[model samples]
Target: MDIREDLRDVSGQIARLLALSNVFAENNKYWAHLKNDEDFNRVYRIPEKDRYKVESIYADGRDMAIYMMDALAEINFNYARYPTLTSIIEGFQNTWVYGNYNKETPDIAKEICSTYDIDLWSVRQMFKLFKDQEKLLAAVRATLAMLQNSNLYKEENGMPTQEKHPHQINLTGINSSSININSDGASAAVNQTYNEPAVFSEIITAIKLQGLDPIIEGELIDNTHMLAAGHKSGTFKDAYIDFMQNVSAHITVFGAFLPALSALL
Candidate 1:
């Protein structure tokens, strides 16, 4: 098998799991199916199968394989929460496309055999080789650990902080919903504009056009940017609290893994 290609495919799953872990927080929840919500309809396909089973080695009883899986699962779980793993998974998933099979043409199997020097039967075995959890999990874990320990999150640091500005505005609840203008005249008029029923983009544009400086704030969430100029803004502490409440969904998957093992056997 193309070791690198197979490794890459397994790594994709690990990254996905880490992302879920980060969001789920607790191990039990991270393994569950809470993420099966309709909002997660987006699907990512992994890289193509580059190598056949002819050169593949059995991964059973290999410590490396287990270590890899452990590492990958940790990373995948984190990404689900922090989104770092999600971005990495997206990168790997978008990098390759699987091959297509055709049977209508005469000697189709022979043609493939001639080019790849392997028959359809061997190709089937190659695919099965990847099904082994030991190898797949190990490969995933290794990739996850590499990404988790990377400098992306900053190894030694507290919570991530945004750029610190010297000047600060303490407008009392100038949120989009209820803008309380402490001043009269133009300030009140501007505050009213903020409460207008305009789209977020339009409001931002208007604020930029105005002579007074305005700021658009929100959390840079996974694969999305949220506007926090109003009541929409939230604290990470709240997010973590909410995450812990639903962490069990992710953990349930581990129990199901045993059934998968049985089926493979």
Candidate 2:
């Protein structure tokens, strides 16, 4: 069988599963309040016909989660040709899927917030944004498309191909700090001192313009803040590059600000 086609099909299935999970979560806000089957059945009184809806949603989510895990494993088996795509899927699995699928929504939120050092409200907003923007789904589809094109080029030429660097954005006259794209196609390098705060502000503003609130939809803001903090703490440039790579993978809308953020490196 053609592994690339299989990967593409599985990725599409993952997108549909994610959309289903998002819809289930949105419609059942009370899912957050219950902890287990006992709690679920005890907390609410519904007609007999609808009694199984919540249970069914959880069961379906768990089954889909398992399917996603298997798909990622299949992708991982071909990691040499698709390292970037594998990393993106792995990140999504670890952060959003994995052990959280069968659990209550609050449990999922708690785990994410504790791991990322963000708040519960931000977690909820992030999920809402996930549903509205379908960012992760878009990222998976784009990465798969890139991989397929790369494969076609390789096959036609009968030559192995190197992975391309992440897309770079160049900003001129921006405080003399610039990330110069390498002529050899390596990742860019920061050359001068730039206004880090302004760059972060611009990114936050860009996120807010997408109809997210500073206080409510704070997950993206928190992530941007962490990136800023990492720079201030003298973290290496590679860390920022890695973060931006993941950001670009997930949120295509923030493409314009990548260079500014990369400049902080």
Candidate 3:
């Protein structure tokens, strides 16, 4: 499998989860089936495959897998997003077409109609003359190119300012849920603990599995510039917050690595 492609797909899920984690939208199925573990699993299951891949860091240990699940389930994230909506869309326009805009590249109809006072019949005729007529008649769509980007990195000491930013790095691991066990003799509840050491080990192994050097990744993250909304018109804090949020979604894979992301540091 292409690692970058996989990462890009994973990144989209993180973005959605970041938006839905605390959502109260009545129609959202995430909350609708949340009480039914099976249903919740169904809705959130697409990325579970990726989680299984990450679980390889544990080398197929059932206990480690259990711990990993517990750790993920317990996390309450202070999520952030990167390449803000503005930046990602801008990047799309810039790259998708020379501009190479996929959808934004204006259609012949729009460009020509704007300059002429032509009637509907004339407009239809004009379109018939254009080659690749189907493309010329296609609907407007945002390429959203930033979604495929697998290039993300961070550097030491260059982290965004502490007070203004949410705890992007200083994650909190709290086991807020519990599982009930019923044995022949008795029933018991267990509080899953966040095993920092285990999580740290897994993170290192998982990153390496991508064939990336953490040291180089750190540098790349620090120096890289992806599109982020609000940066052009907003304060540094706003831009940083947007980038960090996107990063949160990019790395978390729903809930597997979050809260324990503190282990990354």
Best by lDDT: 2
For each candidate in turn, the TM-score is 0.20, 0.36, 0.17
lDDT of candidate 3 vs native?
Answer: 0.28
Candidate 3, residues 1-265, lDDT tens digits: the string is 1222323433432332222221212112322233233222322222443333322212222222232223222222311322233333233243212123233222433343344432333223223222111111110111122233323211122434233232232234556432111112221111232122354335434545564467544322321221111111112232233334544533532256544432222
Higher-lDDT candidate of 2 and 3: 2
Q: What value does the lDDT take at residue 164 in candidate 2?
A: 53
Clash totals for all models, in order? 35, 0, 13
Per-residue lDDT of model 2, residues 117-203, tens digit only = 533343343344333223333323333333334544354456686665554544443565555432233322322342345776677
* Ranking of all candidate structures by their TM-score, best first: 2, 1, 3
Question: Predictions ranked by lDDT, top down?
Answer: 2, 3, 1
> Per-residue error at 42 for model 1, in Å?
39
Which runs of model 2 end up more than 4 angstroms from their true locations?
A: 1-44, 78-134, 152-175, 180-265
Clashing pairs in 2: none
- Specify the highest-TM-score model's number: 2
**By TM-score, how accurate is candidate 3?**
0.17
